[model samples]
Target: MAGQWVEVLGGIMEGSGQILRVSTALNCLLGLLLWVQKIRAGAARHA
Candidate 1:
């Protein structure tokens, strides 16, 4: 039982580390995409 607990916690820690990194990268990409769209919309409005 104790071994299972350790294994589960280790797995969660390892998985979450990668997920955090991926989510951070995805968030940045989405933010940049939104910013680009906003700029384009503003330019279109002006024109």
Candidate 2:
């Protein structure tokens, strides 16, 4: 799935880390992972 992309919008869930983990795994199995607005859970921690 190289060169392919997947977009995941945040703020719909409580854990961005979980989202990242799942998305990363999916990316590995599927394609590229593009996470947008992923600061809804831990904005300051990410900063």
Q: Which lDDT tens digits does candidate 1 get at residues 1-47?
A: 11121111222323445544554555565432111112122222344
Task: Give per-model TM-scores.
Answer: 0.34, 0.55
Q: Tens-digit lDDT track for model 2 on 1-47?
A: 66665567766755777777787788787667565565464555543
Q: How much lDDT does each candidate structure score?
A: 0.33, 0.67
In model 1, which runs have C-alpha deviations exceeding 4 angstroms? 1-14, 32-47
Q: Candidate 1: minimum summed lDDT over ten consecutive residues — where?
A: 1-10
Clashes of 2: 0
Q: For residue 21, what is the lDDT in candidate 1?
A: 57
**lDDT (Cα, 0-100) at 15 in candidate 1:** 49
How big is the positional error of residue 26 in model 1, measured in Å on the Cα after superposition?
A: 0.4
The Cα error of candidate 1 at residue 12, in Å, is 9.4
Error of 1 at 23 (Å): 0.2
